[model samples]
Target: MRRIRRSIGEYINLYNGKRPHSSLADQTPDEAHFGTVRAINSGA
Candidate 1:
């Protein structure tokens, strides 16, 4: 059970952090979200 949960968690992380989405202009979700935050914080 623990192994299955771990596998699912890893896949979720990979999907969000590594896989790019076409709707986001080919950026991974994390990159798309955090990049915008960084840009805003930098006042760029």
Candidate 2:
């Protein structure tokens, strides 16, 4: 159970942090995601 949980966490992180998105013009998830982060920061 512990091993399975760790594997799931790793997969989630990999997908959300490393995968690239065509919608973001070939940017990785991290960079594509940061646009939203920057927008929120600017709004605040």
Candidate 3:
């Protein structure tokens, strides 16, 4: 239960408000999800 709660918190931060994902070009996951992706060495 505790582990699950901790994972949920981590996910919320990583995918909703924190964690500058490289796929997002250093933007938060929420930004990427909302089409706010920036241009970086994405290999795209």
- The numbered model that scores best in lDDT is 1
Off by over 4 Å in 3: 2-7, 36-44
In model 3, which range of ten residues has the least summed lDDT?
35-44
- The residue pairs in collision within model 1 are none
Displacement of the residue 26 alpha carbon in candidate 1, Å: 0.3
> Per-residue alpha-carbon lDDT of model 3 for 11-36, expressed as tens digits?
88777777787876898877776553
| Model 3, global lDDT | 0.74
Q: Please list the residue runs of candidate 2 whose C-alpha ends up more than 4 Å from where it truly belongs after superposition.
A: none
RMSD of 1: 0.8
Model 1, which residues run further than 4 Å from truth? none
Q: Model 3: how large is the Cα RMSD against the reference?
A: 7.1
Candidate order by TM-score, decreasing, is 1, 2, 3
**Model 2 lDDT per residue over 1-44, tens place:** 99999999999888777877788787777887788799899995
Estimate, for each residue in 1-44, the C-alpha lDDT of model 1 and write its tens digit: 99999999999999999999999999999999999999999999
Q: Cα RMSD (Å) per model?
A: 0.8, 2.5, 7.1
lDDT of each: 0.98, 0.84, 0.74
- Return the TM-score for each candidate structure: 0.88, 0.62, 0.42
